[model samples]
Target: MTTVIFIHGTGVRGREYEETFKTIEKKIYAERPDVKIERCLWGDKLGTSLLASGASIPRYDETLALDEEEEEDKEILRWKQLYCDPLYELRLLLLKPGEERSDNPFAESPLDELRSRVDNFTPSDKLQAKLAEAGITEVFGEAREAVIRSNAYNEAWDNVSAESLGEYSNVISRAIAAQAMLICYQQEKYAPVLTNAKLRDQLVELLSLDLAEAELGLGDWALEQIARLALPIGTNYVVGKRGAVTNKISPMPCDILLYQARGGKIRDFIRETIAEAEPPVVLLAHSLGGIACVDLLVEQSLPKVAHLVTVGSQVPFLYEINALCSLEFGQPLPEHFPEWLNIYDLRDFLSYKGSQIFPKVRDELVNSKQPFPRSHSAYWEQDKTWEYIMEILPR
Candidate 1:
């Protein structure tokens, strides 16, 4: 099946993709009724995972000789694993009360309460040992030693401010909840346990027995409740950030996952709609979605995607960007790119800076420069960009 996956760029949410996807899908469907159509929404759950992963992308390279690099990598890896494989940490965090197994929501509250007790708390010798094993000595060491640690956990209860720890903590919590939902969706074996009441009852009882042996305070019931609480929190987060990024060019790692999941869903729909169809795909992508398609293309071959139309694309050589804060825009494109097209507004500062690397794929460059009234947001609002896409899409 020929599929045109519409990946939204940067801080734009999946709904924007839906509006754009439907518009394009209807045209393709009408043109060729026998063809299939699919839209992949990798944006939903995968957004947070991608953001967490990006957040975990170790702002510094571990191979660097600098001590700070090693420390930063350690923290990045820790945060990455916590999002990628959360159950293990959740297991460690579960707080046990003596005998009774309370509801899942409060199961880990006990451990959190204890962790809050220390005054500028130093890591326990045991935690330090674990950190050593993980090659993360100063993971939270500096953070623990901060003046903020001295404030009672409840101190934030009375204060309502934008920079409050309460706000950051809630963000972390929501990010985690999104991850838990992804885990549930990804693992098929866990699905039945979540869906069937009879199985859930049996599993909860089984987990309870394990808890008893470990002397952990949490029961199966509590863990289940936590998962339930996390899903909604994560969903609301994606819905909230529809199309907005203040200073940054792209959504963080977790947000990317959410975007990709949405993209994947749309891809599936396109595939179902157009069976045994092979038509050139024209992707009108902006910002991070442009980079994501490049990454996705590495694994998923698009035989029919004749033109990858990028607007305000930031597909730079990662090494180049790291070495120089500003990469001299290069027209040399990589061999890996499929048939390509690019549109950039000279007014947009980001477009001016991004590598014109698209031409490197085939040593071919098709530069379509249009004057946009607004700086960054003009990619969609301008009528000329759509005309350019319709002109460039392979017939």
Candidate 2:
């Protein structure tokens, strides 16, 4: 019997997360009654709680009351204590300066350390140049500027009645955080780096500082905002909470795959799931989950995934970051690589055609008639998604 293993992507947790898969399971069972299906729940295992609910907001009077000696150190110390060290290693990995191309054409330079990180896997000279240009300073500058210019926060506060201060603030905080992520992700150049946790933290840190300067507190509300923004990038939760906050933060679907690809806490879970499953196993992974499955096949040397399918995944873009654990540049597909099919919609910015990049894989482009993330997410709800999976399953 074939066991179809469904691995979910980021921003999913609790009963709601399970229900999403259960809906798919029902669909799968109806078509292939003999097939067994199970979901890999890795969110709680690898998830970190970065935000708290009840951090004290510094009053404007308090800011005014601070001694000159305390003022200079306060901002610096708050950022350093909260964010600097946590992002240090990641900054090192991503921000190393690139060397100029030499006249000799063969001489390596100091930047090779950065280049070697994804030597063969580098996407293109143009893309490499773009990656080389990436720096935390530029990221911070851009985010800070955007936050200062945006009227979204002010409007949110203005709309709040005195009686609804608490609830409105929470909503506004989430909106601002979401807006920050959206602004960052919408940038074509920066979108690829959004998966890099250190960079994401840097953006949030700078944005938080801007918010604080604009009178938002560095309290539980801000922490939660940063945490929520960091979710998509697969960063470990760095903020701590004091009072109870509503569990509105969901796991980013990409986090599970990104973290697992990096040898995260879910490694054993993946191994055990594959080992215990019945033979002729098929992997039906969505979004980043597909990338995780590919990583398993390449990095872990598991050759038993007979059939593999991906829906609305960013695997092609991941190839640009040198993050895809498998399929290095110019390398032939592994002899044991599973039969692969990738499905995506044109409207989904995150989804891309993978067959051209990974020649062995088949690509299916369907029109979702939705915009952006909705297109990325709408795959499961469509009948065509099921048809494609059923078409590939062993008869």
Candidate 3:
């Protein structure tokens, strides 16, 4: 059995994190009971807490509070301690090179002297008795554990949210499946070996072929739909009745449009993720994720990607440019590609019939025959897609 590593995409954190992980795990194991799975959590603990409180957690915050303070006076005090304190700056200094449990600057602060007073500051019995005239009462409880989790935290931490739950789930599953597939790709498990560079070229060529074949074979209704999605080639169109001719055909601009619609900040994210990760990895992009992958691949920024698989993606035809994908969020795709597969469904209206950019590796191109389900998400539930992906996975 192959081991699959799951990576969550934006707006997922806190208690919702536990539920999301559990749901994905259950789905995978239910399909292949013997498969071993693990997770790579990129989330921060403190960010989770601030989000739970409905406060914006900046990247600099590192601790999450379990209990909330709501009293007007207490809330102001909590804000000073939590947000404006020298404590946070001190923490940063402590985290600097070669310092984890060393002495803190707080020891030199006036707060340190105030803390010292606690040793000798208990009230005397006579004083307590005198104060009893006012009839003041105080209540205190021992500390107990409390859990804080929310999608807001996830958005704060993961930079994703609940509204696009379906899309995010699909993107995460593709990454997980790619990790599983990388196992086979490394081992050359399938009859035709597919490497990242080879697969990318092959897929681009296949997209060209498939688009050609689809255009040739489509019924009148299908052709009309394709025409609607395509930018008119070799023609001049008036821009906004200014009556000027433009050389290029512009499709509806789905990738950038979806990126904004999904509330995702796509630009720095993919490039930053690629810059940060270590080598020898697989990239699984779902829908807009495919656009991200194209950005990384085209730039040759992610040279270590062993394989890439895009599922239910509209990315293959996203560009009018021949090189990299021309989405607004990232730079164009490479003329050469990584080992990749564009998985799609005929019934799913969200995906293109065939992407236009993927080029062939050798004469041989790997296209698995499977029916991707109705929803953009149903690919995860299909045994054929999962099994085919596993067969190509690198060990």
Candidate 4:
């Protein structure tokens, strides 16, 4: 009879968590009848929150950050459409007669020009984070080269750059996206991203932002005619959602930040919870919960905690990058860190592999047949995820 304690991920709370917990319990019992199901429901009490109302939202007094965020989202949304249909603006431009300037590739090719610009390019932290999630380590090295040299981008540039920088921005953004998608598509072992709208959108949005930011910095005419096609519709949508947008999803970041900055409380709660559980314990954690477990086990040894299973977890990636709270880069996990089983869905951006870091860990791939945001949470309901658990689970 083993004790399995569940430590949930970020932003999950109350009734929603209870439902998920019950479902998980039922699933576990259906497989292993003897094990006990316990949970460390820390989000409601120990988690981060804006108890001061919107006071902690950092300049929320003027709603400045929210407004800026709102604008970025709209811009990203606009870029998403451009990536989805790389030739969208070009097609629009062609619809109306534009002088095909004779100052074409022979004089100075777009690829040649783009290569020079992107040579000194560095992906923004946000874009780098997204590309990293896609398993693209360096955004500029091979991937960028491929995009610049590719026939797809060249043809689009030849046709569009003559029109305006606004339209040409589409070509550049789409090229980066094409290359990024190609990488993601290749990295994907289970299924193509084409059918996965959420995943595709994510890759597109990030790649678009990467190039869009670059262009903005270089002062490209990308902003020219940005409002030409759908000005009223996009404006209306942003104005309508600006008020309630941040309120709904802001606290989750507080939870994560507090944990990283001063997470002793969260770790203490887990330690206490472990002490209450029976002799042999398996800490089954998801998302942020997994990060906490890694920190907890690293700080002190819990022999009773036999195994640490992380689903849709970032334990390894954080450790590798030295972003993990307790452990630093190149530091080995404590000898008593337990036999780790990391279950990751390729489509889940939140999940990462630990085998490369810990060496002793087992990295299991479980495809939930879901995409992006959904893939992160889908592990709870995935059959393969459970199978991976049951393999070494104390029966």
Candidate 5:
């Protein structure tokens, strides 16, 4: 009998992915009735303390009082507070007067002329003026105040460029350029701007530049927030929770996975699971779970699992972050690493190809065209995902 062990990714309890694993189990059993399917249940182990500590589900009355929509909006605002606002504030730094000119092509054109016209071009003044022109001054004023009050906003301003906000002034120029393009999109008088393919391309190029710049300034915190937000939203959307904003869940488990991986707890758990499993084990791990598995296989000496399957994983990126246990700069894959297959979807922001990074492993790119959270979670439901796994299993 083959032992099929399933390990789930971050931001999830073991049971959350039960349906996906069960589906794969059913398919495997149809072909090989003797297969014994087991779940690592690592997430459950991590959450045990919380559950034991009286982290109960909200009472019925409390749940009833909870406006999911309001809560979701608050969560979204919290996400923007953590992720977008830092970039926004940094972008504002660009609007400050007497800053150096941006080399960005868009910054040289009509957009530069617009920035020159804003009185003083200070952050608060420029933002207020722009919001007034957009007819959202009141709403944006409140939002801006909220962001200014946030710890993330203050920390970013302090740590990123406390001396000269001038260093990031170009970001504001790009924002003005984007606003110009958006204005063109809205006004019939600027219809030609939209129809001109070259203009459209230039606009896209400018926007891309803006994002790249923002990413550089936003640093690691923004990346983590993006990853955390993507998974739950993707999974919830895939499972028909599209309109349910209250479904925005925490990525706390992701933190748990990282903590465990760094502390060697995950390695210990994997070792225990492998020691107890029957021979010819097929290890199937998703997302962060895949990263954890790879860490164990590389850093420790353990009995060989016949095959390793990683779905919608961020192993490559995780390694880049120095989160992988045995990863070394320019080091080759450890000799004992199992035969590996990585499956990822283009739409899943958290997922990326690992074969090039760990050259021995093979990779397959499957399109799960669903948006953020759905794209990340869609792999398990895809028949192609299982086909790849089945191919690696011992016959």
Candidate 6:
């Protein structure tokens, strides 16, 4: 006899989380009725709270922010992305065919100038102070490496003419810097900075200060604003339905921060749930819950916890960035770690691959045919998700 424990992600609670849990249970029962199914619902008990009752959310009820504040906040979230992936934007650069090789073999390479400038460039004092205050540990060197190795950087290098090399200095350095102070504001530490709209821009502006001052403005920021002029209805949420949108997304980042800062309670909740369930166990977790389960399994061996299934999860990405609570970068998974199956959809940017990093693990693909944000939550609705789980359930 086997048991499958359902662990839900952040920002999910009460009725909706319960209904999805039921859906999963119903699917499992249809396939393997004898197998036990239980849930690990930790949001209500341990989720982050808005003690100020969302006093922090600016213009909470307003149809619009009545200012550039909303736009600036969106920009801040862009950099918070750099904290997770330094090359997040660099990778989006449109690749142009590199300059046709100069007929002269000895023409000095434009890339040489970039390397020299990168080596000589000094990080500003303000940037250093800000980095320290921002809880940005161990990023610049990695960011530099990531930028240098990026396809966009290489493409830019190849595309530059010796005459244009000077123009490209700030572009390349800023690329190395990525979004200039581009740490995504997803962290609780950045909460105060985000509240003050100027700070995020100051942070981004300070990022550019340390780079080339001649300022050719060589960088291409892919904000990629889709002009849906015809979709007047799309603006309704911002015009009059701010609360509906605000309330739904507000908890996501805060919950991630809460788990990172103090996730012991959440993990302990999982242990408590496990203690009540029969062995052997299948830890079926989604999103942040999968991350929690991975952390738990890596920290210690629970023999009864036999298999792990993570859907639309960031476990691999977190580990890669050394942000995971239990494992350090390059550290091997614990000898007692259970078999893992990571399920993902191509459209879900939040999801990542595990098989490449851990050869023994399996990765399952499901197409929700939905765009991101939506794709993230669509995993539970797919039949393939359950079919894959049934194949591995210990009979």
Ranking by TM-score: 4, 6, 5, 2, 1, 3
How many residue pairs clash in all the candidates, one count each? Answer: 63, 11, 42, 0, 5, 6
> Once model 5 is optimally superposed onto the true structure by TM-score, how far is the C-alpha of residue 22 displaced, in angstroms?
1.5
Give model 6's clash tally: 6
* Per-residue accuracy of model 6 over 1-395 as CA lDDT, tens digit each: 89999999988876657767766787788878899988788998788767887676664333432222233233344443443454544444344335555534675454564555565655678877765543343455655665666676665555555554444554454455442234433222222232222333444455554553444544333333211110122354564655555665767888999999999989999988998999999999989999999988888789999899999989888888888889898998988999999999886778999987776679999976544455687676566787899888999
Better of 3 and 5 by TM-score: 5
lDDT of 3 by residue, 197-235 (tens): 233223323322221222221112212222223222221
TM-score of each: 0.35, 0.49, 0.34, 0.56, 0.49, 0.56
Model 5 misplaced stretches (Cα beyond 4 Å): 48-248, 252-263
Where is model 4 more than 4 Å wrong at Cα? 56-240
Pairs clashing within candidate 5: 94-169, 233-373, 234-373, 234-374, 235-373
Per residue, candidate 4 scores C-alpha lDDT tens digits across 1-395 of 79999998888777557766876787789988898989799998977665776654342223232122223333444444443444444344434444466556457655445545554566778766655544455433665676556555445444443335433554465555545555543543222232334454566555554543333333323333343453322444444665455555665676788888888998999999999999689999988889999899999989999999998888888887779889889888877779999999876778898888898789999875553455676676666778888887885
Task: For each candidate in the order shown, give its overall lDDT on alpha carbons.
Answer: 0.40, 0.52, 0.36, 0.66, 0.55, 0.67
RMSD of candidates 1 onward, in order: 20.1, 21.6, 27.5, 15.1, 17.4, 19.3
Q: Residue 382: error of model 6 in Å?
A: 1.6
Worst 10 residues of 2 by lDDT: 59-68
Q: lDDT for model 3, on a 0 to 1 scale?
A: 0.36
Between prediction 2 and prediction 4, which has the larger TM-score? 4
Scored by lDDT, the top model is 6
Error of 4 at 240 (Å): 4.4
What candidate 2 gets wrong by more than 4 Å, as runs, is 51-250, 253-262
Query: With candidate 3 superimposed using the best TM-score fit, by how many Å does residue 363's alpha carbon deviate from the native?
Result: 15
Cα miss at 135, model 5 (Å)? Answer: 45
